[model samples]
Target: MRVLVYGSGQLAQMMYLAAAPLGVIVSAVDVSNETVVHPVSKEPTGVSLQNAIEDANAITVEFEHVPEHLLLDADKSGKLFPNVASILAGADRVREKALLSKHEIPNCPYLIITDVTDLDNVIASLGERVIFKASRDGYDGYGQWRMQSADQLEKLKSEFAKLDLVKVPLIAERMMQFDREISLVGARDSEGNVSCFSLAENLHFEGQLHVSVAPITDLSDSLQSQANEIFEKLATAMDYVGVLAVELFQCGEELLVNEIAPRVHNSGHWTQQGCDTSQFEQHIRAVLGLPLGAVDVRGVSAMVNIIGCTAFSRDLIGIAGAHLHWYGKEVRTKRKMGHINVVADSHSHLGNKLAQLLAFLPVEHFPELEAEANRLKNYTK
Candidate 1:
C-alpha cells in the first residue's frame, strides 16, 4: 500500500518511518511548490502532483493548513481521509467554532471579529481578559494577542485596525481559569471504531509545547470517560477517519475544548515509544482500513521537546528507555529541533529520568523542565 501526505514536515517523516515496516510506502507533497518529495530526505521525487495522487492508495495531511486548492484536488481523488471540511474546520477558527457549536461540544466562549469596532463590546461580553487569535494560519504563538485590561483596548484596536479583518478575522476568547492543559489523541477507523491514547498533561512556554507527561498522575476513570465522550461526539459528528487530537482545558472536573487538530499532533509524540502502536502508524491504519492497534501504554512517559537548541549531549539516551527523534531541520529560535521520549515503570521513575535527562540539556532552552521534573518526582496515587 502507498499513501501520500500533504505537508512535508516532521509528521510526514514520522509517518514514513512508521509505515515502512507495515509494507506501506509514504510520500509527501511540498504544498508550496506542488512537487512530491521524499518524506525523510526531502529531495524532489520528480513525480507530478497529478501522478502522485493517482498512485496513492490514500491521501492525508500532516498539518491542517495545506492550500485549499491542493486539498480540493486531493478530495477529487476520493482518497482524502477526514475529508476537506474537517481539514478546513481545523484550519479556520471560525469554522472550528461553528463545528463545535453545531454539535453542542463545549468550547471556550468566543466571539468573531470582522471589524475593529467589535473590540468595543469584548470587555462587555467576554470580560477584561481576552485572547485574540487569527481565524486562519496561526499556530505556536504566532498571530495572537492578549488584552489584559480595559485600558489596553485602544492600543489593541489600533494594531488590529491595520489588518484586513474581512479576509482573516479574529476570534476573541474569554480566558478561563483552568488548572492544567490536557489533550486526547485518538484514531477512528472508517467503520467508526475508535481508539484513544491516555490523556497527556502538556506544559507550554511562550505558547510552544515544552513537555508532556502521559497517563497523568491521579487520572480518574470519570475524567477519561468524559474526554472519550467529547472525542466521540466530535469524531462521529465529522465522520472523521484518521488520527485526531483535541486539546482541552480542565476547569476542575470539566473539560472545555480549546482547539482541535485534524492531523497527527505534537502532543501525541509520546505514543511513539509509550504505547503499543505509535500515533503515526495508527493514523495510517485508520485511513487505509486496517484494524486499529492497541492504545495500551507501556508505562508512564514524558515527551520533552528539544526546541531551538541542538547542542545537547546525545548520551542522554544512555538512560534506559530514553529515545531521540530529530527533525533534521535548520535551527531557528523556538523551532522544534527534535524530541526525547522517556518511559519508566512509574511517575516518580519517569520524573527521575527527566531530571537525569536535564543534566545534558541547557536549562535556558527548556525553562519548564526542572519544575515539571520536581512536580512528578513526588507524585503519589
Candidate 2:
C-alpha cells in the first residue's frame, strides 16, 4: 500500500517508520514547496504533487494546517482520510467551537470576537478571567492573550485592534481552574470500528506540551468512560476515518472538551512504548482500511519532550526501558527537538527512571522533570 501524507514533519516521519514494518510505503509532501520527499531523510522524490496524489492508495495529513489549495486537490482524489471539513475544524477555532456546540459537547464558555468592541462585553458574559485566542492558525501559546481582571481590557483591546479581527477573529474563552489536562487518542477505521488508547495526562509549559504520562495513576473508570463517550460523539459526527485526538480539561469528576486534534497528537506520543499498538501505526491502519490493533497499555509510561535545548547527553536511553526519538531538526528557542519515552512496571519505577534521565538533561530547559519525578516517585494508587 502507498500513502501520501501532507505536511512532512516528525509525525509523518514517525508514521513512515511505523508503516514500513507493515509493508506500506509512505511519502510526504513538503507543503511549503509541494515537493514529494522521503518521510525521514526529507530528500526530494522527484514526484510532482499531481503524480503523488494519483499514485497513492491513500491520502492523509500529519497536521491540520495544510494549505486549502493543497487540501482541495487531495480531496478531489477521493482518497483523503477524515475529509476536509474535519481538518478545517481542527485548524480553525471558529469552526471547532461551532462543532462542539452543535454536538452538545461540554467545553469552556466562550464568545466569538469579530470586532474590538466585542471585548467590552466579555467580562459580563464569560467573566474577567479569560483567554483570547486567534480563531485561526494559533497554537503553542502564539497568537494568545490572557486577561486576569477587567482592568486589562482596554490595553488588550488596543493590542487586538492593531490586527484585522474581521479576517481571523478571536475566541474569548472563560478560563476554568481544572484539576489537570488529559487526552484520548483513538482510531476510527473505514468500517466505523473504534479503538482508544488509555488517557494520557499532559503537562505543558508556555503552551507547548512538555511531558505526557499515560494510564495516569488514580485513573477512574468513570473518567475514562466520559472521555470515550466524548470521542465517539465527535468522531461519529464527522464520520471521521483515521486517528483522532481529543484534549480535555478534567474538573473534578467531569471532563470538559478543550480541543480536538484530527490527526495523531503530541499527547499520544506515549503510545510508542506504552501501548500494544502505537498511535502512529493505528493511524496508518485506519487510513488504509486495515484492522485496528489493540490499545492495551503495557505498563506505566511517560513521554518527556525534548524542547529547544540540544546540549543534553544522549546516553539517557541507557536507563532501562528508556527510548529516545530525535527529530533531526536544527534547534531553536521553544522548538520541539525530540522526545524520550520511558516505561516501567510502576509509577515509582517510572519516577526513578525519569530522575536518572534528569542527570543527562539540563535543568533550565526541563523545569518540570524533577518535580514530576518526585511526584511520581511517591505516588500511590
Candidate 3:
C-alpha cells in the first residue's frame, strides 16, 4: 500500500516512519513547490505531484494549510482521506464553529466578525476579554490577538488596520478561564469504528505547545465520557475516516471544545512511546481502511517540545526512558526543532525523569523550567 501525504513537515516524517513497518510506502508533497519527495529519505527525485497522488492508495495531510487548488484536485481524484469538507473546516475557524454548532457540540461562544464594527457588539456580549483569530491560515499562535480591554481593542484595530477584515473576516471567541486544557486524539474507520486514546494534558507557552502528559491525572469518568461523545459526534458528522484531535477546555466539571485538528495532532505525540498503537500508525491504518489498533496506554508518558534553540546536549540520551525526535529543519527563533518523549511506570517516576532530562537543556531559554521541574518532583513524591 502507498500513502501520499500533503505537507512535508515533522508530522509527515513521523507518519512515514510508522508506515515503514507495515510495508506501506509513504511519499510527501511540498505544497509550496508542488514537488513530490520521499518522506523518509527527504530526497526530491522529481516526480510530478499528480503522478504521486495517482499512484497512492490513499491521500491525507500533515497540516490543514494545504493549497485549495491541490485539495480540490485530490478530491476529484476520490482519494482524499477525511475529505475536503473536513479539511476546509480545519482551515477556517468560521467553518469550524458552524460545524460544532450544527452538531450541538459544546464550544466557546464566538462571533464571526466581518468588520471592525462588529467588534463592539461582540465585546459587549462576550465581555471585555476576547480572543480574535483570523478565520483562515492561523496556527501556532500566529494571526491571533487578545483583547483585555477597550484600550487593547483600539490598539489592535490600529495594528491590524492593513488587514482587510471584510475580505477574510475573523473569529472572536469569549476568553474563557478554564481550570485545565485536555485533548483527545481518536481515529474513525470507513465503517465508522471509532477508537479514542486517553485524554492528554497540554501546557502552552506563547501559543505553542510546550509539554503534554498522557491520561491526565485525576480525570473524571464523566469528563472522559463527554470528550468521547464529542469526538464521536464530530467524526460521524464529518464522515471522518482518519485521526482527529479535539482540544478541550475543562472549566470546572464541564468541557468546551477549543478547536479541532483534522489530522494527527502535536499533543498526541506522547503516544509514540506510550501507547499500544502510536497515533501516526493509527491514522495511517484508519485512512487505509484497516482495523483501528488498541488505544491502550503502555505507561505514564511526557513529551516536551524542543523549540527554537538547537544547543541541547547529546548526553540527554543517557537519561533512562528518554527518546528524541529531531525534525532536521533550519533553526530559527521559535521554530520547533524536535521533541523528547520520556516514559515510566508511573507519572511520579515520569516526573523525576523529566527533571533529569531538563538538566541537559539550556538554562537560558527555560529559566523557570528547572524550578517547575523541582515543584513537580516534590508533588509527585
Candidate 4:
C-alpha cells in the first residue's frame, strides 16, 4: 500500500523507515511549495500532487500546518485520516481551545484577542503574566510574546500593531505554575479503537523540546488512567485516526491539556527503542485501517534531541543502548538535526548510560545531558 504524507521533514523520514518493514510505500508533500518527494532521501518523486493523492491508499500528515487547498484535494480521495476539521483544530489555537472546552477537558484558563484593545481586558482578567500566541503557524517558540508586567503590554501591542490580528488572532494564556510537562501519544483506528503509549516526562529549552524520558518514573496508576481517558475523549471527539499527541501540565494529581499535535510527535521518539512497536508504525497501521500495533514499553527509554549542533561525535553509539537517527539537513541554529535514543534495564542504568554517552558530546551545547542523567541516577529500581 502507498501513503502520502504532508510535510517532508524528519518526522516523515522516520515514518518512511517504519513503513518499510510493513511493506508500505510512503511519499511526502512539501506542503508550502507543493513539491512531492521521497519521504527519506527527499528527492523529487516527479509526480503531480493530484496524481500522488490519487495513487495513495491513505493520506496522513507529519505536521498539522499543511495548506488548506492541499488538504481539500486529499479529502476528495476519501483517504485522509483525522479529516480536515481535526487538522484545523491543531493548526488554530482558538479552535483547539474550543474543542477542549467542548469536551469538558481541562486546560489552562485563557482568552482570545482579535485586536490590541482586547488585550487590555484580557490582561485585566488573566493578569500580567500571560503568554500570547498567534492562532495559526506558531511553533518552536516563534510567533509568541510574553507579558511579564503591565509595562510590557504597550510594547507588545506596538510590536503586534502591524499584524493582521483579525485574520489570525492571538490566544492569550495565563502563565500558571505546574510541576512539569508530560505528553501522551496515542493511536485510533477508523473503528474507534484506541491504543496509547506510556506517558513521557518532557524537558524543554526555550520552548523547544530537548529531552524526553518515557514510561515516566514514579508513575502512578491514576495518572496513567487519567492520560488515557483524556486521549480517549480527544480521539473520539474528532473521530481521529492515526497518532495523536497531547502535551499536558501536571498540577498535583490533576492533568491539564496544553496542546494537541495531530501527528507523530518529537516526545514519542523514545518509542523507537523503548516499545515493542514504535509510534510511527502504529500511526501507519491506524491510517490504513489495520489493527494497531503493541504499545508495550520494553523498558525505560530516553530520547535526547540533537538540536543545531552537528559537531558532536557520532561515537555516542559506542555507549551501550544508544541508537542514533540523524536527519540529513543543513545545520542551522535551533534546527532539529537528529536524535539519539537510549534504553536501559533500569532508570539507574539508563542514567549511567547517559552520563557515559555525554563524554562524546560537547558540554557547552548539551549541559542538560548530565543534569538529566543525574536525575535518573538518583532513582532506585
Sort all candidates by lDDT, best to worst. Answer: 1, 2, 4, 3
Question: lDDT tens digits, residues 1-381, model 2?
Answer: 899999889999999999999999999999999999999999999999899999998999999999999999999999999899999999999999999999999999999999999888899999999999998889788999999999999999999989999999999999999999999999999988888889999999989999899987789999998899999889999999999999999999999999999999999999999999999999999999999999989899999999998999988889999999999999999999999999999999999999999999998999789999999999976
Write candidate 3's Cα lDDT for 1-381 as tens digits. Answer: 999999899999999999989999889998888888888667885878888888889999999989989999988879899899999999999999999999999899999988777777877788888999999988989999899887787777776677888877898899999988899999999999999999998888888888888888776888888899999999999999999999999998888999999999999999998999999999999989889999889888888888899999978988888899999999998898898888888777777887898779986655445554554566553
TM-score of each: 0.99, 0.99, 0.96, 0.98
For model 2 the local lDDT of residue 253 reads 93
List the candidate 2 regions with Cα displacement exceeding 4 Å: none
Taken over the whole model, the C-alpha lDDT of each candidate is 0.95, 0.94, 0.88, 0.92
Q: What is the lDDT of candidate 3?
A: 0.88
Candidate 1 segments whose C-alpha is farther than 4 A from its true place: none
2 versus 3: better lDDT goes to: 2
Report the C-alpha lDDT of model 4 over 1-381, residue by residue, as the tens digit: 999999999999999999988999999998867989998788899999889998899999999999888889889999999789999999999999999999999999999989888988877789989999999999988998898888898899898788999999999999878999999999999999999999999999888998999888889999999999999999999999999999999999999999999999999999999999999999999999989998889889999999889998888898888999999999998899999999999898899999998888877766578999999998995
Cα deviation of 30, candidate 4, in Å: 1.9
Poorest lDDT segment (10 consecutive residues) of candidate 4: 360-369
Q: Write the per-residue lDDT of candidate 1 for residues 297-365, one digit (tens) a residue.
A: 999999999999999999999999999999999999999999999999999988899899989999899
Q: Is candidate 3 or candidate 4 better by lDDT?
A: 4
lDDT of residue 17 for candidate 3: 95
